[model samples]
Target: MVPKVPIDLPGTRYHKARVAADALRQQLTQIIEERRIALRNGRASAEQDLLSFLLSNGSDEEERGLTDDEIKDNIILLLYAGHDTSSSTLTSLFKFLAENPHCYDQVLREQLKVASSKEEGELLEWKDLQRMKYTWRVVQETLRLLPPAQGGFRKAIKDFTYSGFTIPKGWKAYWTVNATHFNSKYFINPKKFDPSRFEGAGPAPYTFVPFGGGLRICPGNEFARVEILVFLHNVLKNFRWNLVDPDEKIIIDPMPLPLKGLPIKLIPHSK
Candidate 1:
């Protein structure tokens, strides 16, 4: 979508985006106020979480703390950047695994090994996470096939030439992850969901960037990885789920999502 086009005029998609942003800011403002009150009354532990740390400036009085509005803005930024990407990836991962029973079995086996190593009611730790090699490959392949971020925009720092085309300096450029992900030069039978491709050295640098590449790569990449892996480990250990719509098509409304929302039926694992 040509979002940069001067289409913010009423009734346009740009206008709609602006309206949605305003609504979100208002909601975050209210939440920030509630958090501030909780911190003052000891209702919520200060430095307990990101919001608290932001408010307290890492418990340092000398360091300047973020203003209430700044804290709210950051909360909005993190939610906007991190929330949907991880959720969509998780949904797609499960959907694909359910459709490919072999992959699901492999994932389940790997997770079982980790689960058995831990005592009953024991939580996953860093060591257990390190053992999730196959599951991580599945995550990698899922990201390759269905990247949560489709493309990103970057302003050209200098004029450049590629494929016999010259791009002028300061011109904005868009890089599509799908093009690289599916390129034959970088992958063999790119459409195939073979997590084995991730076993060795993996794809060339900058070629397999689901979180992006280089200096501007996402800062939350590690956080997202830990969150997804931990969630997957627990979910697989405790429950089995099946996609209600095996053939549900993914549609990208800016980001990829199932056409009808990825509905699933979950059954708790029997002892």
Candidate 2:
């Protein structure tokens, strides 16, 4: 059965959503404006220049590339999912690394090897992403333990049988990544966070979907991966990190938000 809203009004819902979205847009625009002013005189990198030029100075065809509504929706969607998911995932990854010294040591060693093998002497390149397989495994394990989009709801289009239970048509199903991930039947050593589980035998595409599956899978997963790895690479290279408290509890929510903010201490890497 679909969960019924206590107070439902179709008109009121859109109106409320619009008002909230508008307020958020205003706040974000203000923050962007502030950053623009701050970086106005600072040495702008090529990437920054490219981003500013592309968003601000549009060509004639580019202007028509996306409608005002499309642009607004995409930008808003990016802000909503892109910011928090990546941050929360990164935080979880950090916490995992801090708690598991073997994992940390392995990552550090791999990063150092990567650093040494950079022939281009560039910070990060598209090709370098392919070489970070172990790092990718680490991320996969992190998602298994702390998936950013923790839970979601789906409505059955027709009657379905799941686990021998008949789900009636139009029933709303509440599902969670955490609930399925730690199942012993689905994973080996379900409680242990081991990146190697993904090495030879990868999870079924849809079974371990952090970014959903099929066509609805996040379009930005590749983009997200690159960004995450880039940020992690720099942080790992420049800093020696340790958790303030190793035994702290990890609390998961529907949003995959941490109950306790990951407090890590980073000292400059002194060799």
Candidate 3:
């Protein structure tokens, strides 16, 4: 059985977590310092990446800029949020595709159609991204099943009643994506993996929120979509792989990850 103690409790796990966190903080500080130097040398542009954007001059004199520590904090947030979510989504997606070969073939066919339209050695552009309909549907289905951000928190702006409970002002509100994803009212056979659910207008506005919704919707949603699709296009076009341990289970220590780290055997595609 797993230990049921809180993370803050003094224990080996807590010590390890603290050490890992400090190491990560150090690394991020180093990266922030390097970017500051690059900016000083004019080797990097303000519009380049998230780091550059944060380090850029404010739009107007009234706009205050971020401190070096603040910039590092934002970098840590993105590195923590953006990296794991996409990586986990991709891992789960590939696992699903490998298990469902028919879906894999369908996705492969659609991707190949997109590939044929592009010139040799040319990179995918906005048009290519728009054409990846089926693949995106598959991605949606995967996200619904195993959202990287299982849920998030929001602070109540004022006193309100929800589901008959009077929530006082200053209380925190939480929403779980699973509530909708697993509900029969919102999904037909919620347990089944049906990409068709996303074929048309898809689930109602807030009902299928793998990436939260409304004002707090993930700012990087489009970036994540482009990143995942581009990755799929490249990998599926050049290689195929089989799971080394088909029976491996997914666990959520904090983020969803295959218990065995998703070991696989790669097979290169013939030209």
Candidate of highest TM-score:
3
Model 3: weakest 10-residue lDDT segment is 54-63
* After superposition, candidate 2 runs with Cα above 4 Å error: 1-22, 25-71, 119-121, 165-171
TM-score of 1: 0.85
Which stretches of model 1 miss by more than 4 angstroms? 1-6, 29-48, 55-72, 268-271
Global lDDT of each candidate: 0.85, 0.75, 0.87
Q: Is candidate 2 or candidate 3 better by lDDT?
A: 3
Show where candidate 3 strays beyond 4 Å: 1-9, 12-15, 30-45, 58-63
Cα lDDT of model 2 by residue, 1-271, tens digit: 7855545455776567777898977775674455445546564432564234433443223644444344455668878788888888898899888888898888878887788887655777887778888888999999888888876778888999999999999988877786668877778788899998898878755668788765567787888898889888878877877888776777665355545576789978795
Quote the positional error of residue 51 for candidate 2 in Å.
Answer: 12
Error of 2 at 256 (Å): 3.5
TM-scores for all candidates: the values are: 0.85, 0.73, 0.88
TM-score: the better of candidates 2 and 3: 3
lDDT of 1 by residue, 116-229 (tens): 998988888888888999999999999999999988888889999999989999998889898889998998999988899898898888899888888889999888888899
